[model samples]
Target: MKVNFKLACPLLLAATSAFAGGNNEPTAHRYISERIAQYGEAVERCEKIAASRPLPDESVIEQLRDYSIDDVRIFLITRSSLVSEICEKPELTELAYAIGVLEGADISGTPKEIVQNIKQLVFGEATWGLKKKYLELPVSVQNILKKTDYFDKPFDDIAILNAIENAKKP
Candidate 1:
C-alpha cells in the first residue's frame, strides 16, 4: 500500500503534539492547541507587517521594480487581511514572514531577538551559534541584513553582537 505524505503530514503533526508535554489534555485537544498556537504566531507576524506605514506609490513601484502603481496600492490595501489569512493557514507562515521582512515590518522583538527567532523558524532550534551559521542563513535573511543599515559597520560585526546579545536574553 502506498502512503500519501501530504495526508500524513497533519496526522504526524497531531501525533507528535501528544508527546510534546506541558499539558495533560487529550491528544486531539493538544493537537488543536498546537495548531492554534502556530496560527496565532503567523497572525501576529502578519499584523506587524500590516501596521507598518504604507509605502508611497512611487516608492513601492521603485522597490518592486516591476509592479505598476495600481498593483502596489492594491497590495498595500490587502495587507490587513493577511493576518486573518495567515492565522487560518499555518503552512504559509514562512512566506508571510519573508514578505513582512521585505515590507519593513516593525517586528516587536529587539534585533537580536528577531534574528534568533528567524534562525529558529528557518533552521530549527538546534542550530545555535549564529556566527557559525551566518553564511548558512537563507537568502531572504541575508537580503534583509544587507538592506538594514548598521551605521557603516561590517555585517559580521553586527551579526556577532546580535548573537551575543541573543545569548544574554533569558
Candidate 2:
C-alpha cells in the first residue's frame, strides 16, 4: 500500500499541475461564434476584392487594352473575335466545369488569382467529376491556355494534383 501510494502521488501531482494550467480549448459556443465572426470578415474582404476586379476577358487582346466596357460593346464588332481562338467545350459533360474554369481563367488576371483559381478549380472540380482533367486536356489547348493570362508559371499536372491533395488535410 505504501509503495503504490508513493508512485501514485507523483503521477497525481503531474496531472494536477497540467490541470492547473487550464484548458487552452474554448467552449463550443465561443468557438462557433469566433468562427462565424471570422467568416463574416472574410466575406466582406472577398466582396471588396470582387468589386475592384474587371470582367477579366477584356484584357485578352493587346489592341483592345484601352477599351472600356462601352467601347467593347459599341466599337468591337460581333462576338469580340477572340472567343474561338481560345477554347471550346469539353467532350464529356462532367469535364465541362473544369474546361469552363480553365477557359474563364484563360482570359486575363494577375498571376495570384490565376494560380489560386487554377488550384481551387482543380481541387473543387475533382469533388464533382471524381477525377482530375488538367493533364487529360489536349496538348494544343494546354498550350493556348499556357499563353493566356490565367495560366501561371510552373503550371504542371503534378503541382496541381498535389495542391488538391494537400487541401484535404485537417
Candidate 3:
C-alpha cells in the first residue's frame, strides 16, 4: 500500500502540472474569431477607401492589397471585372472555396468537400447554361470555371457527391 501510494503521488503531480499548462493555449473558436475580426477590420478599411476615392478597378485592387484581408482576397478579385471573367466559368467559386477551406486551419476536408459539392449553387443561372444559352448571358460560367481549374482535374465527383449526400442526411 505504501509503494502504491508513492507511485500515485507522481501521477497526481503530473496531472496537476499538465492541467496548469492546458488553459494557456487559446481555444479553436477564439483563434477563428480573432482571424475574422482582423478580416472584418480590413474589409471596413477597404470600404472606407472606396467611399472616399472613386478609383478604377486596378486602383481598387491595389487599395485592397494595402489592407490584409487574406481570406477574402479572391472576393476582391471576384468583385472586379475579374469576376465577370471568373463567373464565366462554373467552377471558379467552387475551387476557390475548396482551396480556401483546405488552407484554413479550423475547417476540415469534409466541410471543404461539402463546399465543392455545391458547384451548381455557385454558378447560378446568371452564368452556367447550355453553351449557346451560356454565351447568351453577358458572360459564360464555363470560362470562369476553366480559368480557375475549379475541380483541379482528375475530378472528385464521387467524393463531392458523397459529401452532398451526407449533408442531406438528418
Candidate 4:
C-alpha cells in the first residue's frame, strides 16, 4: 500500500509551527529588567549569607555566575552608582569584572575618564588570576587597564574618588 505524501507534509508543518516562537519570549526591556532584578536578588542573598559568617555561600556565587556577560554589563552600566557596593562583595565584584574584561566592554573616553570608570566598576581589588586575565584582554582593553593604574596599588576607595574628581578637570 502506498502512503499519500501530501497529507503528511501539512501535518508535519502544523506540528512544527506550534513549537515556534511564542509569547513566552520577553521583550528586550523586560528581559533586561528581569535579569537585573534577578542579579540584585542574588547579590542580596549573597550579602545576607556573608553577614552571617566570614565568607559567602558557594551556591550564591554559582547563582551569580549564571548570569551571562551581557547581563553583567547591562547591570554595571545601568546601576553604575552601585559600584561601591558591588566592589565590597569580592565574589560578585570579581565575577562582574571578569565578565566585563572577557566580553570587551567599550572602555571609551580619555585615560582619566576610563580610569575613573574602571575604579567605579571595580571598587574592590582583583585577584592575581583576574589581573592575569585582564592582561590577556585585547590591546584596547589592556591599554585602558594600564592607564587606570589598576596595578599601581590595591583598590583604594579614596584613590578612586580622587581620580574621579581629577578626571573632571579641563
* Worst 10 contiguous positions by lDDT, candidate 4: 1-10
Off by over 4 Å in 4: 1-26, 54-170
Tens digits of lDDT, candidate 2, 1-170: 11222343344334433222223212322322233234334333433443344433434433233333333332222121122111211212223343344445432222222324333432354333322233343444334344455332112222332333354457
Candidate 3 runs further than 4 Å off: 1-26, 55-170
Comparing 1 and 3 by lDDT, which wins? 1
Better of 1 and 4 by TM-score: 1
Number of the top-ranking candidate, with lDDT as the measure: 1
TM per candidate comes to 0.26, 0.25, 0.25, 0.23
Worst 10 residues of 2 by lDDT: 80-89
Candidate 1 — what's its lDDT? 0.36
Q: Give the number of colliding residue pairs in candidate 1.
A: 0
lDDT of each: 0.36, 0.32, 0.33, 0.34
Model 1 Cα lDDT, one tens digit per residue, 36-145: 34644554554454334343334322343333333323332232232234344554554345434533534322232333433344334332333334444444433432
Q: Write the per-residue lDDT of candidate 3 for residues 1-93, one digit (tens) a residue.
A: 112223433443334332322231234223322333343343344334333443333433333333334222323223332323332233333
Stronger candidate by TM-score (2 vs 4): 2
- Rank order (by TM-score, best first): 1, 2, 3, 4
Off by over 4 Å in 2: 1-26, 57-145, 150-170
Question: For candidate 4, what is the lDDT?
Answer: 0.34
